[model samples]
Target: MKLHNISFNNLRRRKTKMAFLTIGLVVGIATIVTLVTLTNSMSSDIGRKMDEFGANILITPQQNGLSMNYGGISLGGVNFDQKEIRESDLALISTIRNSRNISAVAPKVVGAVEVDRHQVLLVGVQFDKELKLKQWWNVFGKAPERGDELLLGSEAARVLNVMSGDTIDIKGEKFKVSGILDQTGSQDDSLIFSQLPVAQRLLHKEGRLSFVEVAALCSGCPIGDMVLQIAEKLPAAKVSAIQQVVEGRLKTLDQFRRFSYAMAGVVVFIGSLIVFVTMMGSVNERTTEIGVFRAIGFRKSHIMRIILLEAAVVGVLAGVLGYAAGMGGAKLALPMMAEGKQVQLVWDGVVAAGSLGLSVVLALLGSLYPALHASKLDPTEALRAL
Candidate 1:
């Protein structure tokens, strides 16, 4: 009979012991796969949602300012003219190398306007892009879609004594209050939002942008590189990244990935230990059988191969069954782990292949010492056990 046939027959004879070993390996592999899959899915979902929270790149006109100090005393100095970023220059942002990472670009034109004799800051924005960038905005009414419609902040509406559906005059033009934003604890809570063209016309700064907000925090986006590229494209504009926001989100995702890996390591160690202990026990029980084979002219290599073959078979079975169980567990556990977010499980062929290979390699390593011990047994000494 061939060496593999002997290994197969031995496994069939020791069903109970082999089953225990298989179960241990399967459980470990399944736990690992489940943790890794869940972490990846949750990180992706959270990253996408966080990316939509706000803009990570800020584009503003670069201005020159002078500071005057005399005799250790500070004094206000003359300021140079503030350069305006042309609205037409925004298209250059799309020409950057990492432009594909850019999600939303909100161009804003800010100026002061008078309403009911009260000075209010008027921020011009493209409603479509603005609304998309600020998904967290809770408006009391609908967003403005027309030049004659206006969205008011909480403080702006309160100070102006206006609500949704109220008409207000700005610079002698009548604008309907389409919505009042909830108090956001930011400057936005005291400003009025209007259509880009209308505000530009009222502010007399046509085709000029005060600043731009770009959302570009996608998976693996190089934020620093993107800032430099955008700055290179718009030389007159100062482009900078909001480091705190990007860093916070990245740190959270990194923690998730690291946690999964750490847990997987622990499981892998335990799985290997189980395989080692079980294989050692099996080898000890078959010492007399090993002696019989040695006396029949079986080589040490053959004996070793037979022992390893058994482990290889068990590892293969464990890998397949483990992967199936892991995916099922991940699907069931996703809802609770994702903070109620519904995340879909992805069947990655590469992960499946890796898990299979990992199981086999671990099995071989765990059984290596036991196999060696079995091969080195003396025929006479082992036969005494018979």
Candidate 2:
């Protein structure tokens, strides 16, 4: 019979030991897979929600500005060209190559207006797009539902002594205060939000926009490329990406990923140790059988091959079982841990193949010393015990 046949037959005879060893490796591999899959899922979720978090790009008209400094002296007179972005031209933004990544495009027209005799800044916005972009906004009442309705910022509401359902006159037209924006501690806090077209007519700045805020997917897909694409489509507008938010999120996810890897490594190490100790014990118990084989003219390499072959078979079985269990565990755990978000698990064939290969490598490394010891068993000494 062939030496490999002997190895297979030996494994078939020792079902208990093989089963225990397989289980050890399976648990180790399963833990690694679960952690890795969870981390990947979390990263994807963060990337998707990046847009809802807020705008990552700000589009404004490109214009020249005068420096307030003169010969490094104390002179401080500043002048800048106040270029107005065209509201009609904003549609061209959808033509960019990366337009699919844009989640919201909220344009605004800002002007000073009198509300209840108090001078307040009025910001014209498309209520639909603005609400979609600002997920953090907590309105005390309803958002504007009509052209004659506007939202009052907390500070602006206080100054105007107005609340939701109050009426105010803007440029000889009555407008309803539809809602009061909760304090955001942002520039939005001190402004009154009006419908885009209504504000355009009220401010007498029809066809003009102050600026546009864009929410882009931030899965590290080169925001710079998006900026370049936007600039190409809207050459009159200066497109710039706000990297602080994206960078901060990316950094947080990266740290979490590193922690998962470290944990996986530790689990793998413990698994290798379990396999090594079990393999060493098996080699010792098989000493008499190995001696008999050596007496029958089997070489040391043949003995080593038999031991290592058993390990390889166990590794293959363990790897497959581990991957299945890990995927199941992750699926059950995702909903509870992901905070109401549906996490889509990615099953990569390459990852499965790599996992199987890693299992074999781990097993071989763990069994190397025991296999070597088995090979070195002196026929005379082994037979003396028999």
Candidate 3:
């Protein structure tokens, strides 16, 4: 009979012990897989949601003003001509080194316009990018479609005494109110929104933007690096990143990842220890059998192979069961853990294969010392136990 067959028959005779060893390793592998899968899914979900909370980087016109005391009276020094960014030049942002980290770039043309002869801030925006950037804005009605259509901020609508579906005049041209925004308690609350091209034409500042808002945060890229890169690309525009939201999310994720690593480490250690103890016991029980094989001319390497082969078989079984259990655990645990947010699990085939391989390797390492001790047994002493 082949050595492998002998190993297989030995395992068949020791079902109870094999089952215990497989169970211990499976539990460990399952916990590890669950933690890793959950961490990966959480990172993606958090990153996407954080990206939606609006632009962390503000690109606005660089102000050039001087303040000084003149003739015993404090008077501000004359300011240079107002600088505006050209809409055409916005594409240069995509050439930055960390440009891929930028999620959205929403340009705006800020100008003062009259609504029923009362002056208010007029903000022109590309609805596609603006809508994505300001996802927190809850509009009661639809976003503007036509050039003549516009959305009113909550405070603006209140001040103008108008609601959605009302008509108002901007820059001597009639505009239909398509939507009214919910109260946001920000400067946006007092601003009126219109399509970029239409507002530019109305304000007579075609292709000139007051500022741009950029959303830039991803898995592990530094926001500061992105800001520097944007500044390099657009030297004339002031680029600054707002860190409140991004920093908070990053801090939370970091803590979560650390906890996962700690727990996984503890579980893996316990699993390896269990495998070692079980293999050691198996070696002791088979002492007389080993002695008989040695007397019958079995080589030390052959004895070692039989012990390792048994461990490898158990490892294979544990790995398969562990993966299945981990996936199931993640699916069940995520809802409770994440507070009802839907988390789509991203399958990592590499991790799955690695877990399988790791299980086999762990089994081999755990059984090695026991197998070696069995190989060095004195036949005369071992046969006495028989």
| Best model number under lDDT | 1
- The sequence of per-residue lDDT tens digits that candidate 2 reaches over residues 1-386 is 89789989989998999899999999988888888887777777777677667787899888876656667885755657757689888888898888888888999988998766788899999989999999989998899989988898899888888899999998888988889999999988899998899888888999999899998866766778988988888877888988786687678778878988998899889989988999999999999999999999999999999999999999999999988988888788778756565667767676578678878888888999999999999999999996
Error of 3 at 320 (Å): 1.8
Model 1: how far residue 240 lies from native, Å: 1.0
Q: Predictions ranked by lDDT, top down? A: 1, 3, 2
Model 2 has an lDDT value of: 0.86
Q: For each candidate, what is the lDDT?
A: 0.91, 0.86, 0.87
Model 3 Cα lDDT, one tens digit per residue, 187-237? 988989999998888888898998899987666768888889888888788
Return model 3's CA RMSD, one decimal: 3.2
Best by TM-score, which number? 3
Predictions: Cα RMSD each = 3.6, 5.1, 3.2
Q: How high a TM-score does candidate 1 get? A: 0.83
TM-score of each model, in listed order: 0.83, 0.75, 0.87
lDDT by residue for model 1 (6-120), tens: 9999999999999999999899889988988887777777676667668989999999899999998999887797787999999999999999999999999999988999999
